[model samples]
Target: MKVTLERTDLLKSLTHVHRVVERRNTIPILSNVLLRCDGGQLALKATDLDLEISEQIPAHVEQPGATTVPAHMIYDIVRKLPEGAQVSLETSGDNATLELRAGRSRFALQMLPEADFPDITAGEFSHAFTLTGRDLRLIIDSTQFAISTEETRYYLNGIYMHTVTTDAGERFRGVATDGHRLARAEVPAPAGASGMPGIIVPRKTVGEMQKLLEDPDAEAQVEISEAKIRITTGNVVLTSKLIDGTFPDYGRVIPQNNDKTMLVDRDDFKAAVDRVSTISSERGRAVKLAISEGRMVLTVINPDSGSATEELAVDYESDPLEIGFNSRYLLEITGQLRGDTASFSFADAGAPTLIQDQGAEDTLYVLMPMRV
Candidate 1:
């Protein structure tokens, strides 16, 4: 195979496929990227058994062929090459090595037979849909932080995605919970998504998909079945195996009748929590929020560290409520609010508190209280 491409174009393609290549692999071929040159295009592919990503970019093809080479090494070589320089890659039929050349630099990389690469089976998807990059970014940014890292639960280790019917109409929703906290966000369901089965998108897939959705103007085509999910853009395609577990009914955990409510400036609340959390215990990082009439005081006390307090005025009229929660959780949820005002609904210190953006009703967060 012989191909010539500008450094920038080759580097971009490498960045996308490299994410799927593991630093260490039990199978030697798994650590290498499959490169195929034909029809004036170069296809780079990488996989980690469970997930696969492929990118195709324009290149000058002098000879048509394919080979596998260390994914990271080639990417690094091309990346460090002089900017705008032309890079040439070639491997003769008798050679088991890939020769890379750019200006005054050259390197010979060992190649594996393309036939040794594992095949990724992407069965027919039951549902196919399209979504703007903006819609996908919103759903992932809002809920990804709350996904469970606990391996024991397995099911909570990803974002739970499905379609739901709201008072306004039907929407696509993403929910994540780690028992202590839960985040739920939704966007109007796109066309072709009707009756789509809910799927748990694994954490790694969520991150890689997020990267592909960075271009706000790009549209992503998504296909899904009970066992796997695929996302395709103009330049790349990513496919992954779905987690084989059922997500718990998250709707049941959201507070239903927490009538007492308070509206506070999102920035003020976040700042207060951050300052008071300085004195919080290392293990719990707990902060107590005491709200009364029209004032809210955030206090943190640790046995080894001195206590700290910060007060923020809020629009609270209900009876006083004192609740303790993980300071990090509060900051993360508040950061997701798009508007200046963060609305909080409370039932008591013992029950979960519901929080939402006063200006955006599509997103919601639930936080379980800890005993102070």
Candidate 2:
């Protein structure tokens, strides 16, 4: 393949596709990116068997052809080159090496047969919909933190996506949980997603897809089938195999009758919990939350270390209650709240506590209390 492309443009495209390439590979072709020059564009593709990413960038084609070259090495070489430098890439014969040139620098990179690269076949998707980049990013950032890293519960290692209709109407929802905490968020459902089947998007795929949605103004096209899911935006496409196992029914973990309600400044509460937890090296970083008529106190105790307590004025009228929770879980849930105030509802110290963003009911967080 012989093509001439600007260094800045090439690096930008490589930045997107190179991340999908595995750093270490048992198969030789897996470490290389498939480059195809056709129709005034250079298409770069990379995959790690389970996930594949492809990007097309504008280029001047001298001799149209295709070849495979090391993904990371080429990325680094182009990245270090002077800005706006013109890059020329050409491959000699069938088994010949790949030649790269820019100004006074030139290098010959080993090439691999393009036929050895694994290809992911696009499946027949039963449902396809579009979402704004801002909305998609909200769903991922709000719930991805709660996805479990536990290998045994493979289903919980991804965000669960499906369509649900409230008493009002149908809405698109995303749910994620580890054993200790759960997060759920909803947005307006797309026109054709009414009967879409629920799917667990694996953790790695969620990350890669999220990266592509960084442009808040861009829109993403999502396609889902029984076995896999695909997301496309601009010149980029990402496809991944869905986790086959079933996700736990998360509704049961959310408490409905929690009567005690406490409203506190979100930042203040986060700061208090963060400070108090520092004293308790043991007890699994537990911090006790004591709520009374109009005051809330955070306390942490460790015999070998020390104890800490901080008080803050809150909006609570329920009976006094004291509950223990892991500090890390509390911070994660509260961090997702974009507003200034945070509300918590509790039944007792042993029951799960429900958290919400003051007046917003569309998003909810549930935390399992710990025994102190």
Candidate 3:
């Protein structure tokens, strides 16, 4: 294949596709990206067996051909080229290497036959819908932090996406949990999303889609089936295999009868927690919250180091309670609240605590307490 394209255009497209290729591959072909030049555009594709991304960029095609080359190598080369330089890619006559040239610099990359690349997106999708980038990003941001990293319970490693009929209307809900905490966020269900099967989208797929949705005004076309999902936005397309295990019914963990309610300034609470946790042991990293009628005191104690305490005035009228929590988890959940006031409802020192933005009910978090 022979093609000439602007360095900026090529670099942008490469940045998206190269991320799908794994750094180490058991299969030889998985480390390479497939490049095809034809019809005045250059198409680049990369895959790691489970997930794949492909992008098309305008180019001056000198000859219609295809080949595979190291994805990271080519991306690094194009990224370092001088701004506004034109890049030329041509295959050698011996058919063993791809020659890349820009200005005074040149490099040759070994090639694998394009036919050896595996195609993971060959099946039909049963459902398709369009979502604005804004709504999609909100759904991901609200829950991605709670996804579990443990491999033993593989089902909790992704966000559970499904439709529900609420009192207001049909809603699409994204739920994620790590046994220690749970996050649920919802948006009004888009058209053509009704009757879609509940699917567990892997964490890696969720992250990749988040990166591609940088344009908030753009629309993403999402297609899905029992086993896979495909999303297309502008010049980019991503397809990923769904996690096979069944997600646990996360609703059971969310406490509904927590009667104690505490309203505190979100920013003040976050700062107090962060300050007190400085003296906490790295392994434990636990902070205790002692809440009374109208006052809350945060405390952290380390066996080897000293102790720290901070107090904040809150709006709590319920019975006094003391609870312990992981400082890192507390900060992450608080950061997700968009409003100035953070609403915390607690059942007791040993039960789960429910947190939310004061007047917004669309997103909720449940955090399991730690022993002080």
Candidate 4:
């Protein structure tokens, strides 16, 4: 293909598709991006067989053709070139090589036949909806950190997205859990999403899709079928196969009726945990929280290393309760709170603790306590 595109435009599109291209691939074509030029636009696509991303950019087309070239190499070449430089791309004579030229720099990259590149078809979707960029980002940012990396429980490696009708009515919900901690967040459901089937969106696709929603003005058109899901907006499309396994029934794990409530400054609690955790044991990273009438004390006792304790005033009036939890889990949960105050509900040291933003009921976290 022979096309001329501004460096900025090409770079913007490349940045989105490159996330799907793996650094190493068992199939050579998996490491390359498919470039097609036609109808006054250029499309770039990349896939690792599980997830695929494609973006179209405006270009001056001299010839209508298509080819595959190394994804990372082309991205680097264009990224390093001077800003506003015009990039000219063309296939070399008979050799199936692609040449990239910008100002005084030029590079020739090995290319493969476009026919060898895999294209994932837009599958049948039973449900489709539109969401603003801000709302879409809130769904991902709030729950993505809880996804599991464990390979055996493949179903837990993604965020569970579905529609739920609460006492307030139908709402779109996202939940993620790694057995130790769980994050659940929801937003008002769009018009046609009632009774939509729940699907587990794989971790990689969640990450790549999150990046695409960074534009404040962008709106996403989401389509879901039995086997795959597609999200498209502003010339970029991401398609991925949903995890086939069923996610664990997360409701059973969420604490039901914990009554004791304690509200503390989020920054203060995070700082105390961070300081005390420094003396915690290497393997457990455990920190103990002792809550009394109106005072909360954080203590870390590592018999082999050292001990630390910090006290903070809190808004607890119930009987004293002591709980131990992994410091990392505490930090992650606290970091996600959007307001200045964080509330925690406790049953006892052994029971699962429930956390929430002081007055917000839509988002909640459940963290299992650790034996100290």
Q: Which candidate achieves the best lDDT against the true structure?
A: 3
lDDT of 1 by residue, 238-349 (tens): 9999999999999899999999999999998998898889888779798999999999999899989689988899999999999999999999999899999999999999
113-192, model 3: which lDDT tens digit per residue? 99999999999999999999988888999999999999999999999999999998999889999999999999999998
Alpha-carbon error at 3 in model 3, in Å? Answer: 0.7
Candidate 4: segments with Cα more than 4 A from true spot: none
lDDT of 2 by residue, 1-372 (tens): 799999998998899989988899998899999999988999999999889999899999988899899999999999999988999999988556899999999989999988888888456989999999998888898899999999998999999999998985899999999989999988899887889989999999999988899899999999998788889999998988889988889999999999889999999999988888888785478888888999988998888888899999999998889899999899899999988999999999999999999999678999999998
TM-scores of the models, in the order given: 0.99, 0.98, 0.99, 0.98
**Position 1, candidate 4: lDDT:** 73
TM-score of 3: 0.99
Each candidate's lDDT (Cα)?
Answer: 0.93, 0.91, 0.95, 0.92
Q: Which pairs of residues clash in candidate 4, taking residues 3 or more apart in a chain or in different chains?
A: none
Regions of model 1 farther than 4 Å from truth: none
Candidate 2 error regions (>4 Å): none
Cα RMSD of predicted structure 4: 1.0
lDDT digits (tens) for residues 1-372 of candidate 4:
799999999999999998789898899999999999999999999999999999899999999899999999999998999998999999956887898999999899999999999878656889999988877788899999999999999999999999998998889999999999999999899876776789999999999988899885788998888778899989999999999989888999888889899999999999999999999877879998999999999999998988999999999999998899999999999999998999999988999999999999778999999987
lDDT of 1: 0.93
lDDT of 2 at 42: 94
Model 1 error, position 84 (Å): 0.5
